[model samples]
Target chain A: MMETDWLLGFAGGLMIGGAAALYLLVNGRIMGASGILGGLLDGSDRAHWPERLSFLAGLIGVPLLLAPLWAPETHLTGNPAVIVAGGLLTGIGTRLANGCTSGHGVCGISRLAPRGIAATVFYILAGGVTVVLFRHVWGLI
Target chain B: MQRNLFALLAGGLFGAGLLVSGMVDTSKVQGWLDVFGAWDPTLAFVMGGAILPMAMAWAVARRRGVSLLGTPIPARAEPRLDHALILGSVMFGAGWGLAGLCPGPALAVLGFGGWGGGLFLLAMGLGMVAAPALRRRLDRLPA
Candidate 1:
């Protein structure tokens, strides 16, 4: 597992950083995931369909290419209500931050954006607090 | 030369890859991290799943001396060890350990359709919204 940890982190980091890098390489826009997902909602891209389509396609399609053929299928950790709420909340969070972990943690940090660095720190801090709240404070998990 | 579309596409692929590899699960991540205690190593696959694409991009970008977006990207050496980096990693670990999710996996886990992911997302977003304030605070602290 230790061997795989570095490998997996590298891969996740690569895929994320690489994607952002590629986008920067090809597009002038920051490959901030929130911005891309937001474009879908803001109806801003009504005039530019190809850009949106390609972006959406790349996000959905790349994982299919990278997932291991025999990797074990994992199940959700909790009930349905937890997953749905989690998604909506995350969506809002990603939007507010102007990017998700990939955008901020991976791409933003790599770029040395002070905001990105700060954002990533808050994210991790929040995450830690959340976990403690749920598991220890609330005794929910 | 910057390829906005390409970047979006690359990010999408990256996100999907995260889901595909099961990197989004908190238990999976913690379990992997706990190798020092019990010796489970499934997380390695998740780490690998992410690196390949980055390497490819680096290789191409270096060889071509141009980003796929058709722009020249600035290169900086790896950042030096600093308080922010150290503090950030510890925070990230704590968050992942407690919430059972990080940003990548936390967001990706949305596909599962449950409250854990949803609440996690909410708090995660809240954290994001609070980032500016946090930054202000962190900045005021001594370096």
Candidate 2:
């Protein structure tokens, strides 16, 4: 099961990279999920609303359509406070930095972009530290 | 019309990949982050696999200069590292550790993540709305 998990992850990752490649080659845009959604929410990229909306329609719509086939689960925490806090921080942080895992982690690192590499390092380090503190030490999560 | 169509196709593929990659699974994500505990190295494979084709795409992009669709390709981001990048990443990481859901997986899981997911999305949206104000305040501070 563990072996399969990694294999599946790799295959799926290839698909993700392929999607990003297609987006860049054909659409001429970075496939940054947060930036796409953020622009729509903040009305900053109004000129490209159609492109953003179309992308989101697929992002949300495909998963819903495929739910019957796979039934994807998040296993998110039941604590509303934790969930809300997590969401707010993710939202604010991604916006302030102008990127997230998809934007900085995948796209940026692939191109060896300095900013992307730096952001990935910090976030992963911070995430590791937070997990250690919250889960290991405090048992809060 | 073609641009929107392709965008939909790309988005659909990306969402499906997230589902297949187990990125939508909070436990897997948290497990990967939990380096102190029983760590899961699955995410590293995912990241590695994702980067391969993307690197190739960047190379192609460099040569082509414009997308096949004729739009100009975006230039590489400035290499300058700023405080916002560092600070925002730290906060994002903390949130990721807390909930195990980043932006892409957060939305991808909405189909079945129930009210908890909905609440998270709502709060995330509100945060995005308020981020600009916070950024302005941060900018006012000395570097």
Candidate 3:
């Protein structure tokens, strides 16, 4: 089961990378979810709204369709406070930093860009520490 | 029309990839992050897998300079180790650790994550909507 999960993960990653590559090679866009959504919201890049909207429509819409057939068992915390706090933090932080996992982790790192690499390292480390603090030290979350 | 179609295709593929990779599974994400607990290292494989093809694509892109559609590839960003990057990343990381959902997976899982996921998505939108002003304020701070 674990091995199957790993294989599926790797295959999925390839598809993600391929999608990003297609976005870049075909449309000349970065396939960053936060960047795409944030740009639309903040009015930073309105000129590209049509393409962005189209892209986002697929992002949100396709999953809705495929999930029922190939869905994995998943669960989010039921706590409203945690949900809200996590959402706000993710939104604000990604926008402020100008990237997220997709932007930095997959796209940026692939090109060996320094900012992408640095951001990935920073966020992963911070995330690891936070897990330690919340789950081990403070017992929060 | 072609540009929009490509965008849609790319987005659909990305979303499907995310769903297939187990990235949309909150438990898998949190479990991967739980280094001190029964840690799951599957996320690393996902990252590694995603990076390989993208790296190859980038190599090709560097030589070509422009996309096949004649659009200019985005230039590499100038590296900046400033406050916003660190502080914001720390905050984002903490939130990710807390909830095990980043921007991509958070949205991808919305169809299945129930009301909690919906609320998270809503709050995330609000936070993103509020970011430009917040960023402007943060910019005025001392370095």
Off-target runs (Cα >4 Å) in candidate 1 are: A44-49, A65-68, A72-75, B1-22, B29-143
Q: How close is candidate 2 to the true structure, as a TM-score?
A: 0.98
Per-residue lDDT of candidate 3, residues B1-143 (tens digit): 99999999999999899988999887788888888987888898889989998998898888999998899999998776777777778777878888888998877767776888788888888888888887888888887
- Output DockQ, candidate 1: 0.23
lDDT of 1 by residue, B99-130 (tens): 45555555454545256555665665554554
DockQ of 3: 0.80
Task: Pick the winner on TM-score between candidates 1 and 3.
Answer: 3
The lowest-lDDT stretch of 10 consecutive residues in candidate 2 chain A is A58-67
Candidate 1, residues A41-141, lDDT tens digits: the string is 64544654566556655654454444454242334456444444444445445554455565565555554566566666665556555555655566654
Candidate 3: tens digits of C-alpha lDDT, residues A1-141: 899989999999999999999999999888999999899998899999999999988888899999789865557888788889889988988988888999989999999888888888888888888788887898876
**Which has the higher lDDT value, candidate number 2 or candidate number 3?**
2
Where is model 3 chain B poorest over a 10-residue stretch in terms of lDDT? Answer: B78-87
* Deviation from native of the Cα of residue B4 in model 3, angstroms: 1.0
Model 2's alpha-carbon lDDT is 0.89
Tell how far residue B53 is off in model 3, in angstroms. Answer: 0.9
- Residue A140 Cα positional deviation in candidate 3, in Å, after optimal superposition: 3.4
Clashing pairs in 2: none
**Weakest ten-residue segment in model 2 chain B by summed lDDT:** B104-113
* lDDT, ranked from best to worst: 2, 3, 1
Taking chain A of model 1 alone, its TM-score versus the true chain A equals 0.82
